[model samples]
Target: MKNADNSRRAFVRFLAGSPLFLAAGIDGKSLHRLITGSTRDQGEAFDLIDQVSQDRQISSPGEALDIFDFEPVAKAKIPPAHWGYLITGTDDDGTIKANRDGYAKWSLRPRRLVDWSHLDTSATLLGHKYDTPIVICPLGSQKAFHSEGELAVARAAKAKNHLQVLSTVATTSIEDVIAARGAPVWWQLYHTSDWNQTRAMIKRAEAAGAPAVVFTVDLIGGSNRETMFREAMNDTRTCTNCHSGGQPRPGVSGRVDDRDNRRKPAFANPAPGAPIPEAGPPTWDYVKRIRDTTSMKVFVKGILTPEDAELAIQHGASGIFVSNHGGRADNSLRATVECLPDIVKQARGRLVIELDGGVRRGTDIFKALALGANAVGIGRPYIWGLGSFGQEGVEAVMMILRKELEIVMKQCGTTSVRGISPAYLASR
Candidate 1:
């Protein structure tokens, strides 16, 4: 076994060196000849390469130059409101741009000769193993996008052997989500002004078998998502779930319900009202409350500062998710990717660090891992996939990303995700 492994690695290294071997023009017999001539473990390597070559054809562009043109097509197909929510970052969206720009500052230094035949992109987090280092980031009210909503996403994640983080504002209930997927799910918690509600939600998530609690720290107050609001206004109907109990009534200062509901004509909007009862900002004490409530692993999202990262660890957070709320919270903040290295350094070994934002390619996944992210959360792309083709769309998106990651690993001369490190990147 050891010798076979070593030979596989050597053959992979040889493949990595020969650019001609990767060309589309190379016939299978010619490639077989090249491999057999180049390495002692030619037979085994040839078989493995043949499998990869077949799979590679699925992603390879034949008559087209732009393989990634599907992204824009998918983007255009999404509803205007959903598209706005997915694409726009908070405030001025500076942080969103920063996320993409940060990737440009780093370059991958592909190794010429290294054994990468047994590459695995699988990752284990919070004691749970996943097929890939990618997880579906929690996005709220997916039901608005499709009928399957969170359930569809959960099914897709289950099929791909990936993790799904259930948002506090998910269209489906936690129990139903678990029932549909029958897999451990991560819960994204939004801190509410009502402590009792927060505690209740946490207890419910635990009872439902959610493996982790990801506390979203940035959206204490509602964001100025003008596009979503505008789209909502244009629509003739409102989502019953969004207007259900717990949400503040429109133009009211506190929660409203069916018993106290009053009908105000769309044309007769003249009542002056106090500010709505939005969720108050959460402090470290809230983190403590979360820690006390659940034995599940805790991860704090929306962390952009080393100071905040330290505070999160000190407050008993098991992990930190570097995010800028997908550029929806505060546009002035640095993109989550830009903040990852520092947070990873500050937390040291005290916490596991993961990140999300502006990730569009498998190379982006590789880049984040190389820059100290234990894993990455994909938000909009999956949604686009969901909106476009429902479960099949989601499956297609996952397949694309996984294939991309495999190809990237093959090209970079590293087979295992663990082998991806800062050494593979240039500090441009």
Candidate 2:
């Protein structure tokens, strides 16, 4: 009984210094009572305390325990419609779940009895070195989640030395994001039907110091995002103030467009019958055309098959971004991680391979690297931080992932990112 009392007292003291406790501004007595169950009846069955205030919600960025910890905070802070759009997947939402579940098919094989006092997590892609292999995947209209939007994300990326891929429909401009990042960033292209406009956007990105252009291709035809529609129905705010174009906003409806009239200066004039420059899909020729149009490296985003991966090389792509548009592009239920090995085999070191979709852990990043991915990407995790606590939250998420990755590296006996390979992983 004395030991138990001492343990409870020590735990309460530890909680007093915890980020969650400090940020939540809980008093020592309250924390002590919460930990001791002082209000409970003596010898009562230990179960859920229905009357206790939930401690899961974080009040500040420092309070976040992991990447997922920010989700509820973000959900609570962001409007219902935007939160729905942020979490939406096409049709049945099976693909979103699959992307996360696919990691279970593989297991890690850690090396034993290796000294790992000094570790490295740096990765290189297209001749550029970054601190970590975790790239910030393109997320459009980040302002819908937070006021600072991509700018805050860029600052966090710069601080953590992670590469950021800016979306075509990003709330902030390319030049500004670059300025905030203090480095060049890759730009994601939508490849709309207007060839002239596409050429102009590509050139514009190159002019803004983007070293590469990632052309997203899986969103052919359109998607049936029932989740976004359902959430938007509950939004009580007036849509017309910003979405005056009589169309669902880009991020809200999953439709890419310059409804805010932000792209008129950089985008080309509308071609015949193609009023929306961000609409329509492209063929392989578009890839070749983009390559021809710019000296910057061209990456083919949303390549999920070995055939498409091979096609990307033939079409003059500098890299293959293995993704399913975060499962928003289709209802195929194919996770990007599941497609990595085959695509890596087909590429055969011919191009840089990167993937993003449902990556929430350091082990997921390690598994991707082991399967021959030069780098990995993340979408919702950082945004969760961004929405909850702006720039600080973004930095917290990056550091958390990096620390987790470092711990995994030490356990696996790998000194650096390049040292991780298929030999360290086994099929489950």
Per-residue lDDT value at 355 in model 2: 86
lDDT of 2 by residue, 1-428 (tens): 99998996787687556665556565556655556665342112112221122356779877777788887778778898788779889886889999999998999999988877768799987777899999999988899899999999999999999999998888788989999999999999886555666677787889999999998887766787877776778799886667654434344444454354443233433434444443335679879988999999999999899999998999999898999989999888888999999999999999999988998999999999999999999999999999999999999999888889998888999998989999999999
Scored by CA lDDT, what does every candidate get? 0.71, 0.82
Best by lDDT: 2
lDDT of 2: 0.82
TM-scores of all predicted structures:
0.74, 0.83
**Listing every candidate in turn, what is its Cα RMSD in Å to the true structure after a full C-alpha superposition?**
15.0, 8.8
Clashes of each: 5, 0
TM-score of 1: 0.74
lDDT of 1: 0.71
Q: Residues 249-358, candidate 1: write the lDDT tens digits.
A: 23322111131222211112222443233355667988887999898888999888899999998899999888887777777556677788888889877888888987
